[model samples]
Structures are given as C-alpha cells and as structure tokens.
Target: MNSIDSVTLEVADPTAAARFYSGAFGLDPSRVRVRSCEAPTTGFRGFTLSLVVSQPGNVDALFAAALDAGATVLKPASKSLWGYGGVVRAPDGTIWQIATSARKDTGPVTRDVDELVLLLGVEDVRASKQFYVEQGLTVGKSFGGKYVEFATAPGTVRLSLYKRRALAKVAGVPADGTGSHRLVLSGATDPFSDPDGFAWEPTAPLTVAN
Candidate 1:
C-alpha cells in the first residue's frame, strides 16, 4: 500500500519553523526538515498540510495552539460543509488546515496532534489520481473528477488530491502563481513530481531477500 512517510518544507529559518511546528502541533521535530530558500515573493497557492483529529475539541485546541505559536489565522475554527476545521498560515508561509468529521462527542482534548494528511492541489485531479494508482496506491474515497483520496496504512500520513482552484479556495489563497511548492513527500520507491509539481522522494524502500 502507498503511504506518505514525511514532508519537508523550505523556509528562511529552519530552526524557528521547526520549533513552531513541534511546539504548537506536537509534531516530531525530527520528521520536519528545515532547509534554506530564497525569499518567495509570490503568494502560496498550491498545497496544504492537514491535521485530521478524531474529535472537534481537539481541532479547536490545536487551532488555538497554532495561533499562540505565532501562526496567522486564515479561517477561524467552525463548522463547514466538509466538517469542522480552520485554516492558518505558519510563520514560514506554509498553509495548514485542522479539521474533524461531524460526529457527536469528540472526546477528550489532547495536547498532541497525532494524525496528519497531506492535500495536494493538482491541475488535473483525475490525472494525478491515476498517477498515484499506477504507483501502487489504492483508492479510498473519490469524487467526480474533482477530488480523490488514497488509503494509507496505519500510522502513515494520508494523501489526497483536489483541483488547484478548489484547493486554493479551501486554503484561502489565490489560485494563480508559480514557484517551488516548498514541500516534499518521502517513502515512495522513487522520486517524482506530480502534474502539479509536488515532489515525492524515496526514503528507505523495503528490501526483500533474493
């Protein structure tokens, strides 16, 4: 099964960015790599990192923590058509969405955000979906040529694809621009970029005996 292992972000200050992510969202600092990058003069338009909590209270708490850690709130936490979620911009300019499903009694709030989902904004959702399937990922839930989600093994980050314009709206960013996505996904057997330019690199592929 196909699964996302890690995500790398390009930022001006790797130390500060890593600190904010680890402290605010309880993400492992080791999982987040910091790299030097030239200042991006354009607005972020392509992708978003998502945290999927099992409960609404966790979403609310995480949203608050993100703001406290110096992230700018793009959309306040509230119920939406998809579910309860809020959008925020990390200090390094990465967009994030914290969301939960519509379920009664979200349960106790935890300080740590455990699960993650990476949403890629692609120019062609169908094409991107087909690409991942060819790469050996099984399709989970998909919508009519607009959105598709891939099933991931336990403890791996889930991946999904959506139309670029639609995703930009969801991320509260403009739909037009060009630059590096400033992100990378590892754990695949080979390094590749999707139709939208999101890079996926091979980490440590499983080895089998001859």
Candidate 2:
C-alpha cells in the first residue's frame, strides 16, 4: 500500500521552527522537518497537522506548551461529542490540532502521541478520495462525502481528506487561502501533486540531525 514517508513544512526560519517543534511537541526532525521558504501565503493553508493522544490531560499538556512556545490558540482545549481536543497555530503559521478520543485517562498522563495525522482540506472530498485511491492508497474510513481517511503503515503519518470549508471552520480560520500550501508530503509515489495542488515527492534519504 502507498504511504507517506514524512512531512516537511516550508517555513521562513528552519532553526526556530525546529526549536518550537522540539520544545512544544517533543518532535524530532524524523517526524516533521522544516525548510526555509518565503512563499506568498495568506489565511488558511488548507491543511492541519493533528496529534492524537490517549487522554484529555495529554491534550492540555501539549496545548499549554504550544502556547508557551509562542503558538496562538485558535480554539481552547475543551470537550466535545467526539472527545477532548484543541487547535493552535504554530509560530510558523502551521495549524495543529491536539486531540484524544478517550475522555478519561486510563494511565498516567504523558506527552506520548498516539497518531500523527496530516489532513488535507480539499475542495471536493469525493474527488480527492478517488484521486488517492487511484494512487494506490486503501481507504480506512469514510463519512458520506464529508471525510475520508486512508490506511497508512505503522510509524508513518496517516492521511485524511476533509471539505475545505468545514476543515477551515474546524481550525477556526477563514476558508479562503491563496498562494503556496507551504506543505509537502514525501511518500513512495512518484512526484505528483494532488487534485487540490498538494504536492508529493519521492521519499528521500534520512539524515539524522546531530
């Protein structure tokens, strides 16, 4: 099955973004990397990087740290019908959502992330779903024509699709965005951009930072 190998965020300051990710989310370069770019972009970027945790406390933990690390709160951490979650925008303008399906903690609270998801907000969920299906991805879940998730290999970022307007609303940002997405997916597929203009590149060799 086709799967994303990693994600790179094009930011203006790679060093600062690296520091923020490290301090806020305990993330390493292998999980999410950063590169320098000043591409023109405004409003919503049409994507969100989500960290799914095990309980509410973890959500709160990361949320507070993100705020302390200079992130702006888009939506305060709170409980919902689906579970507890919150949204924040990193210093580099990348929107992130920290959430958990379990309302209560079953074990000691930790910053351990359960799943890392890269959700692309597409203009047409159905059409984008079909585009990925044709790219060798197997559908894991689908909700009518609103959302679709693709199964990913263990330890890799899971991919999902959501309606552009609904996703922007969920992120608490305006739906209208222009210029570059400022996001890139490194996967096994030959380099290609999706229907919505999200680019995918062939996986590159990993170079662990010192």
Candidate 3:
C-alpha cells in the first residue's frame, strides 16, 4: 500500500523554519522536513498541516508554544462543534492547526502529538480523490464531495483532500493563492503530481534481512 512517508516544506529560510517547528511543535525531521526555496506564493498556500493531539489541554499546550515561537494566531484555541482547536501561521508562511476531538482533558498534559495530517486544498475534491485512489491510496473516509481522507500506513502522515474554499475558510484565510504550493509528499509511489499540482516523490522501500 502507498503511504505518505513525510512532508517537505519549501521555505525561504530553512534554518528558521526548522527552529520554529522544533520549538513550536517539538517536531523532528523524520516526518517533516524543510528546504530553502524563494518560490513566489501569495495568500493561502493551498494546504495546512494539522497536529492532532489527544485532548484539549494538549491542544492548548501546542498552541501556546507556537505563539511563543513567533507564529501568528489565525484562530484562537477554543471549543467548537467538532472539538477544540486553533490555527496559526508560521513565520515561513505555512499554516498549522492544532486540535483534538476530546473536549476535556483525559489525562495529564503532554506535548505528544497523536497524529500529523497533511490537508491539501484542492479545486475539485472528487477529482483529487480519484487521483489519489489511482495512485494506490485507499479511501479511509469520505463525505460525499466535500472531503475525502486516504488510509495510510501506520506511523505515516495522514492525507486528506478538502475543497479549496472550504479549507481556506477553516484555516481563516482567503481562497485565492498562486505561484507554488511549496509542499512535497514523500511516499511509496513513483514521483508524480496530483491533480492540484501537489508533488509526491517516491521513498526507497526498507530492505529486510533474513
């Protein structure tokens, strides 16, 4: 089965981005990587990285850390219909959402992230869903034409598609964006671009010795 191994963000200052990610989210390069790129991009970058935690306290912990690390608040952390979450924009122009489905604290607070999801804002959800399915990804969840999530291998980043306008609204940004997505997905499939121009590069399979 094809799965997204990691995500690479093209930023103007990779050093700063790496520092920010480490300080803000305690992320390592294993799942998220950064590289230097001055690609012209405006408005929303057409994607958002979601940090799914275990509970509301975890959400607040990550959210506060992001603020202290020089990220601007796009949406304040609070209870919502779905759960508790907040949106922030990194200094390098990437947006992140820290959230959890648990409304209250279930246990002691920790900075541990439960899952990392890469949500791509595509022009056509159905078309993009078909594209990923054809690339060997199995559908994990689907909500008609509004949203679709692909099942991924354990310990890999979750992949999902949402309408560009809806995704922008969720991230509290405008839907208009151009130039480059500046995002790359490392996966098991051959290098290719999705319908919305999101790049995917193949990762070498692990060799097991007998």
Candidate 4:
C-alpha cells in the first residue's frame, strides 16, 4: 500500500535540480516553490527537508535557485559530446547531477507498486535495526554485511540500507553525487505510492507494456 511521491535531491537550486530532473525523468518541471515551503518543517517520513525560495533566476535559473538557496556548484554546465550534464554539491554535501538527458527509458511498461528506497548510513547498525523493529518491521537479510533490508509491510517492497563504503562498491562509483546515489528498489516490487503517501493505484492489473 505504501508508495513514493517524490524523491528529492537537496540541490543548490530546486529549479535547476528540477529542470535537470524533469529533462532526465521526463516529468514536468512546474513547481510552486513558495507554496511548497509555506507548510511546516517535516522529518524523514515524507520528504527529507523543505526548501524555501521565491522566484526563478534566469534562463540559467535552475542553477541560480539552488545556488542562492545555498547549493554549492560542483560542476559547470556544458554540452558534452555524450550528454548534457553538470554536477553541483548540495548544502549537505550531496552531489546533484543536472542532466539535460539520460540514456535509458527502454521500457516494457507495466502496472505495479514503486518502492522508494532511502539509502541511509547510520552510526550504529544495531540501534538502527532496533528502531525499525519498533516501527513494525522485521529485518530480512544482510546483503553480505554491507546492507540490511527491511520490509515495508506484509507482501510489500523492501527498503534497504547499506554502509557508504559497501554502497560505493556496489554502485561501482564513488559515494559522491558526481556520479549518482543509488536508491536501490526491487525491480520486482509494485509501483504503488507517491511522495504524499497518496495511492497511485494503477487501474489496470500488472502487465508489462512492451
């Protein structure tokens, strides 16, 4: 029943990040940022944090918005022979990838639940394990001690976590946003929820649209 609404990347500029994300994810980059920030501050349940900003900057506004709001510029924007992308360091040391495009959208589309996994590195694995146990979850298995996964609910998707070192190894890239942080979700799981916890209940049953 649980689902993902949005996966936020704390960027130097929400607009730039959104633009990069929109072009990359094929979503419309039409955000009402001032409205989004009018609400109360939130914890990890929904979004990681709330961003507050008023207007867009320029044709280069995406970069400007994030920078003005305190996003560090990691890479400058440029038209690569391969693709269009630039990297920026977020306020919290998270690397933000602003790409005009991505390669893979090859899909045999289907109806299912999309599990939004959060990759967190906690100080104590034992304490983290106990916390989830209290939150109505059972730790399933450790992926070679690098990760420990938990189930969302009965027959639900698995939300997994891993140490930074191990995650970097699995991702085959540095733990820097220069690459991209992998929010590893089960490809076999259902696509069910959005960021608001609203059900995106696909009317049709599971069928891969090729």
Candidate 5:
C-alpha cells in the first residue's frame, strides 16, 4: 500500500494551514487534527504533528519514488551527520523523512541514527533556543551553543536542535526553509514544547554515545 511516514511544513499560518492540510492533502479532518494539549505538539502556532506510517512494513523506497514523481523538493536527500539520514524538504514546501528500523529492540549493535534524535524547523534561531531554555533546557556547547544539546535520558542517545540555515550553510547545502518537524520520543523523554512552539522536552539529558 502507498504510504507516507512523516509530514512537516514550515507554514506561516498554522491555523489556516490546518484547513489547507486537511483539504489539499486529503488528510482526515479527525485524524489529521492535532492539538498541543493532546499528544504530538510540534508545529507553528503550536500544533501537534500528525505523522502517517504504513503498517506491518518498510516502504522507504516507495516514499522516495513519490518524491521523485511530483513532490516539490525544498531540499535534496542526503545523509545527516546528526545520525538520522533523510532530506529535510523539497521545494514548493514539503518535508519528508524516513523512520528507519533502528529501534532499541533491535539492539545498539544494529541501531540507526533514526532511533536517536529527531530534527525540527524554527523561524528564529535565538528565539527557538530561548523556547527550549524556558522549557528548562541546559544548553550544551555545540556549534557554540547555537545548537541545543538536550538529554534523552542519562545513558541513551543525544538530540540537538539546529537552525536550518546554519546547518545547511555549514554543510554547504542550500537551506530550504523547513518549518515544523516532529522529534518523536525514541528513548526516555520528558517531552515539552519550546516557547517558539516546537514540541520538545527532556526524555533524557545530554551524555556520550558511541
């Protein structure tokens, strides 16, 4: 069956995009509806992201094919130094990423970056950082603390929030303004939304990982 694993848009008007998403994408009015008060709170204007995944399956290739067909790629696909590897977006504003089969159940010997951290898009760098700070985040000194170093626990993996532009600039890739993406809790996380309205919380704090 044809399926999408994840969806995130850096929209200006999330309230308006709520309708646009439901109609244009044919997302269910009921299922597509995500509120921060509920679960997945990761969007502009603070809306929880509703991610879709195929059941009993692994269909990364099919999803990749869909992007090749007509999806406007804002960013090209590439391996991420942060562990999880996937394109940030396609032009005309659509975000796509694969949820790799790197579950903890699979064991650290077979873990993928996908199982550790998740990326998110934000409007402002300092503002977004402040949001995470308000959530009681203790900033780490990575990229000069421009990228947040939060915890997933004490002994698990690490996730950091990076500005799209800076990351792309450093990587020598074009920065395709990606808006809102979800950092789904993989390990023990204390999830909370940053002040800028990005969904994140400390499931685990910063630590070393091999």
Candidate 6:
C-alpha cells in the first residue's frame, strides 16, 4: 500500500526549522529537513499541512502553541462549516491547518495530533485524481468535481486534492504565484510531481548511526 512516510520542507536553516516544529507542534526534529534557497521571497501558495486531532481542545491548544512559537496567525480558531479549525504560517513560511471534527471520537489517545493530511490545491482536480489513481492510490471520498481524498493505511498521512481557487479561498490566500514549493513528500516508489507541482519522492531507508 502507498503511504506518505515524511514531508520535507526547505528553509534557510534546517536546525532552526526543525527546532521550531519540534517545540511547537511536537514533531520529531528528524522528520523536518531544510535546505538553502536563493529566492528572495518564499510563501505558501498551493498546499497546506493539516493536523487532524481527536478533540476540540487539541485544536485550540495546538493553534495556541503555534502562535506562541512565533508563527503568524492566518486565521483564528473558530467553528466553521468544515468543523473547528484555524490556520497558521510556520516560521519558514509553510501553511498549516489545525482542526477537529464535530463527530465524537472515542479512540484512545495516542498523540496530541491524530493524523496528518497533505492537502494540495490543484489546477484540475479531475486530472490530478486520475494521475494519483493510476499511481496506485485508492480513492476514499470524492465530491463531484470539487474535491478528492485518497485512502491511506493506518498511521499514514492521507492526501487530498481541491481546486486551486477554492483552496485559496478556504486558506485565505492568493491563488497565483511561481516559485519552489519548498515541500517534498516521500513514500512512493517512483518520484513524481502532481498537477500542482507537489513532489513525492521514494522513502529512503532508515539508517542506524552507530
């Protein structure tokens, strides 16, 4: 089964970026990697990393923690048509959404964040959905021509696609820009980029440092 092993972000300083995420969101420092960029400005345009938690408090606390860690608040937490959620921009300019559903979850507490969903804003949802289906990902739930979500195995991050303009409206960001995404997804055997330029590379084998 295809699973997202890790998501890498490019930043000016890997150590600093790793530290910020680890401290603010409880992400393992090893999971975040950064590289130098010569570009003048870097901002999120087409994708967002979603943190799905089990409880409403989790959403609030995580959102607060992000703000306390020097993250720029894009949207304050509130109940929305989509559920309870808030948006924040990481120090490195990556956009993140922390949210929880109204549905009650009786699952045991495993972690502060229950699951990660990589939501990509694609120019064409239909074409992007077809491309992923051909790459062996099963469709979980798709909405007419507006949205598509992929089924993922337990403990794996799920991938979702939505129209660029729609996603921009949801995230409160502009829909036009051209530059490096500064994000990389790993797990697929063959490296590929979706219609929106989100790159997925094969998961590298873990190494033991003796």
In model 2, where is the ten-residue run with the lowest total lDDT? Answer: 201-210
What are the lDDT figures for the candidates, one per model? 0.80, 0.92, 0.89, 0.37, 0.38, 0.77
The most accurate candidate by lDDT is 2
The deviation in Å at residue 46 for candidate 2 is 0.2
| Candidate 1 least-lDDT 10 residues | 201-210
Say which prediction, candidate 1 or candidate 3, comes out ahead on TM-score. Answer: 3
For TM-score, candidate 3 versus 6, the one ahead is 3
Model 3 lDDT, residue 145, Cα: 93
Q: Predict model 1's lDDT versus the native.
A: 0.80
Each model's TM-score? 0.89, 0.96, 0.95, 0.37, 0.36, 0.88
Q: Summarize candidate 1's per-residue lDDT along 99-179 as a digit string, tens digits.
A: 888554456687656678888888888888989999889999999789999998878777899888899898887888767
The stretch of ten residues in a row with the least summed lDDT in candidate 5 is 47-56
Off by over 4 Å in 4: 1-6, 27-115, 143-145, 153-158, 172-210
Q: Model 2, range 1-210, lDDT digits (tens) per residue?
A: 378889999999888998899999998578698888899999899999999999999999999999999999999999999999999999999999999999898888888888999999999999999999999999999997999999988899999999999999999999999999999999877889999999888878765432
Candidate order by TM-score, decreasing, is 2, 3, 1, 6, 4, 5
Candidate 5 has a TM-score of 0.36
On residues 151-198, what C-alpha lDDT tens digit does candidate 4 reach at each position?
555333335555555444332345433222212122223444322222
Residue-wise lDDT of candidate 6 within 1-210, one digit each (tens)? Answer: 366777777777666776678778997433444555555444446888888898677787788888888899888888877678888988888889888885444555333977888888888899999988888889999997899999877777788998888877777777776788778887856888877778888877543221
Q: What is the model-wide C-alpha lDDT for candidate 2?
A: 0.92
Instruction: State how far residue 45 of model 4 sits from its true place (Å).
Output: 19
104, model 2: CA deviation in Å?
A: 1.4
lDDT, candidate 5, residue 49?
24
